[model samples]
Target chain A: MSKFLLATLLLHIPLYIYPILRLCYWAESPLWLTLLIFIPLVSSQYMSRFYLRKKNSVWTKLLRRFADFYLGVSPVLLISTLLAEIFVGFHMVTFGTAVTSVIAITVILGIVATMAALSPMVKTITLSSGKLTAPVRFVQITDVHIGSRKPAFLDRVVHIVNELKPDFLCITGDLIDGQGVSEDDLKSFKSVVGPIYFTIGNHEKYEGVEAIARRLENLGVKVLRNAETHFTKELQVIGIDDMDDANQVAVQLEKQTLDKDAFVLLLYHRPRGLKAAADAGVDLMLSGHTHNGQIMPFNLVVNRVFDMIKGLYEHAETKLYVSQGTGTWGPIMRLGTRSEITLFEISPAQESLFPSR
Target chain B: MSWLDEGADVRSTSLTEEFTIDLYRETYQDRFIPLFVVESSGRLRVVTDKADIPADCKIISLIKSDNI
Candidate 1:
């Protein structure tokens, strides 16, 4: 067996098989009925893993969607079952009540979680910029995962961002994760008002970045590949490619001779290198990719992975804001987090005037 | 395969800590699922974990030294 399958199997013994055994015991099911449940339960993981990796047909896509939705619902089911089991253990509920309650709780919470994933809220962040004479407004939407998310979702994001009327849009990374997602699927990006600047995420690398970047460029996105551009006389925007290295922010910043007079705005995909950006005199950095754990206990895991998962973090002179992302990745549900489109309104700082003058 | 990617990939190794198992799809090379988003902060605050952060930030991780 592949390592992934093996690892998945080991994990599922505790996560899936144990839960099934408990449920079967609670209901006193026949061996055949137990087998029926086991087959589909065991197969869901492998089916999703194998089907959605490289290419996709209409059926594979449908299967992927089912698996994705199940992915979201499974967590809810597990948690509900866990809660019911706890109640039963405490003698507060009977096994039959526990089972029914688990189903009811899963259905309700599952729907709620799915709704949370479907809706993307507009989050406004205001900061004091050191270089700008006026407030610069821009919207940031990252990890949209256009593959799992349809283009209509992008259309909704664009419509919302356009309503905000920001100066420009910034996409940090993970814009596409599916090979099946085509350029036409991403046509709504052109409808977003103002310029859209992007850096490739890890998912982009997986989905053939060269092709994805080209598609984004065709749709009028400025794909910044370890590159920089002058947004205005007082603002310099630097885009760093999401390198598979620890000090991507530091290494990329070292290569750029930032304009002393302009506010240095850095767009990186992952949240790291804050001290590096600050040491290099970066004024502000924007990022996404953590998705703030994208779920409940998973957030706990993500917390272990990233130092700054969400919101603003300041280090010396640099400030970083990590977006919660604008779209869902899998299962199309958020247990403890909401999807967001971040709008940043940066006004000039009085302290910044001293250096510029 | 996910473990290999996480163990070997410099990015994954550096980005995450040990014992972090992924339950969701990664979709890199036909990987599994990724779901949920636990939002943080009470408004757009300057949340800090400066005390918990390690001092020496530049830790270069390679899965295997000989792999090209």
Candidate 2:
């Protein structure tokens, strides 16, 4: 097995086993019942990863749903059971009461988190640059993961974006997770009033970049593959394909002829290379791959991987805005983080060669 | 509107209608058509022959034309 797969199994197996064992011990479940619950939980984690490749198969679909549900509820189960054990050790509650309390809390919190994941919040920010000639409004939605999420979710997202009446729409990346994403899944994008631009993410590469790019282009989205398009006389939009290498952004920027006098907006999938963007004379960079870890505590780990986790940061002349993400990735659960669609209002800085009349 | 052959010498004659059409079709493709071609000398013209294209002039993309 590969190192990543091996590590995933090693880490997740224990996570799956511990909760069931503890829950069984507290509830005094029979050995057969314990075995029954344990087998599927452990196997599902591994099976889900592979079977998901057969996206449209009924068995794969069922397994994905089961695995997603298990993952969504597992964190709650594990944390609550741990707390229950601690409470029991402290003699604050009996074993039976502790297990019951944990179960109740997990169920309630799981439902709340699921609901939170369904509806995304919109975050609006305004930026001003001396190079801009006029105010521009745009909406950015990233990591919608349309294959994992149904078209209804995308419909709601599209509705919200159109309501904002943005000058244009940008999708940073990870728009779809599974292969064979149907036209129906992307049909709503055609209804969006403004032009839509997209840059590939790691997920798109996984699902097949050519397929996703073709589908998106057919839907009227301009897929920027290490290329650029002019938005206005004073503004230009550039995008590059996502790469694992840390210096990918810098390398890609070197190829472009950046206009120093115009406002240059970059759509990169990952939030890296702030210095390179600044050096390239890019005015703003929009990204959303981190998902801000998608769940709590995981965010801490994500923070270690990325220098900027969520929100906006300025480096020299370039500004970077990282969205938490518009949708969930693995499990449809969110804690201590929000799913967001970002709206940006950009205007020219108040300075002019000509005096006011 | 007239068209200059692809091989026509641009240095001597003004930009031909054919040259402009080919430039729009080839450079911008079917998606983007320049509404206003601005020359580097700060001179703006709706239509110009190849000879009129300033030596320092650069083609910048404007909004997508509905007709295209």
Candidate 3:
């Protein structure tokens, strides 16, 4: 049992410890209190089982599950605690001061989680039609992980998209966990929306990029694969595959005869190198790999990972819009960040409908 | 009256022959539906709404509702 406990501890530690330590830093707290809090939190599971011996009600059953699960969360807490200890100790900090630091870290994490849950997140961005008389309307929906265990989530999302009635829809990637998706699941995706345009994300690449691309194409989705399409006389849309294939993106761009005034949009799944995209003279870029750090403390860790994590950013003349994604990854619960569908009306500043105008 | 008089009171002249045929076909669906028109008679006024329509013929206002 002890060996099993040690193995379990080792297994779960990395998942929680690295993220908490990297992202959180508490301003003020006593080290002893932080360590003491973990003791009760860890034992809460056993205590709840003991308490359940005397009760037989729905509330008792629910409380027991909560206790078991939350107590299970102690492994994560333990990892985070040890990380705080190691960091402060390495800096030659006193043992008593270490507990304060850990407590402060937890408080900061709690605050971040709370702030994320409370933030007025963007729910749906709709592009009202007739606003622009452009021949082709390209709508980009990025980071929709539809394989979440969450119920009726995709149905509601598709309903929203149908209401908008865009002429063409583009999916920037991370369609599924890739691990969980089956052949039949991919088939169901075909009926979810009208014709779709897709580009693979790192997750898709992980699950055999070529196979996923071929399967999606078979379902009527055009996989851009560093390809360019002259969507309209005034616009040229290019999909610079994912980050790993940056060279392919450059090669494809070289083949296209890009006009200075043409509306150019690039869908690169990861937001790693915005400079390359800007240098490539991409007018607008769409990406959604970050999920903006799906969890609470993870958001801060993710914030540090990339320059443009979420929202519309202007770099010189290029506009980069990183959506938070339309679906949750694991646990089927989005504590901090809400899923989003971003719609943009790409038009010139003036009323010149014709490119010549 | 010349052959031009037959369509002189038409409100608008559709450039395409297909569109003109379709418009006339649409009138057959509902006989009560009005089709009043006033075409250009060498600077002649174009009767568009029911108010300017000749009482003998039914008049259909292009404005279905003022809210639109």
Task: Name the candidate that leads on DockQ.
Answer: 2
**lDDT for predicted candidate 3 compared with the true structure:** 0.53
Off by over 4 Å in 3: A1-138, A148-152, A187-194, A245-252, A255-261, A351-357, B1-68
Between candidates 1 and 3, name the one with more favorable DockQ: 1
Task: After superposing candidate 2 on the true structure, give the runs of residues whose Cα lies further than 4 Å from its correct spot.
Answer: A55-59, A352-357, B1-68
Could you tell me how far off, in angstroms, the CA of residue A5 lies in candidate 3 after the best superposition? 19
lDDT of 3 by residue, A64-97 (tens): 5455334333333555577766777688765446
Looking at model 1, residue A165 earns an lDDT score of 93
User: Model 2 clash tally?
Assistant: 7
TM-score of each: 0.79, 0.82, 0.53
TM-score of chain A of each: 0.93, 0.95, 0.61
lDDT of all predictions? 0.72, 0.77, 0.53
Against the true structure, whose TM-score is highest? Answer: 2
**What are the candidates' individual DockQ scores?**
0.02, 0.05, 0.01
lDDT tens digits by residue: candidate 2, A262-351: 889999999998999999889999999998988766788899999998999999978999999999888887888899999999987897
Q: Residue A103's C-alpha lDDT in candidate 2? A: 77
- For lDDT, the strongest prediction is 2
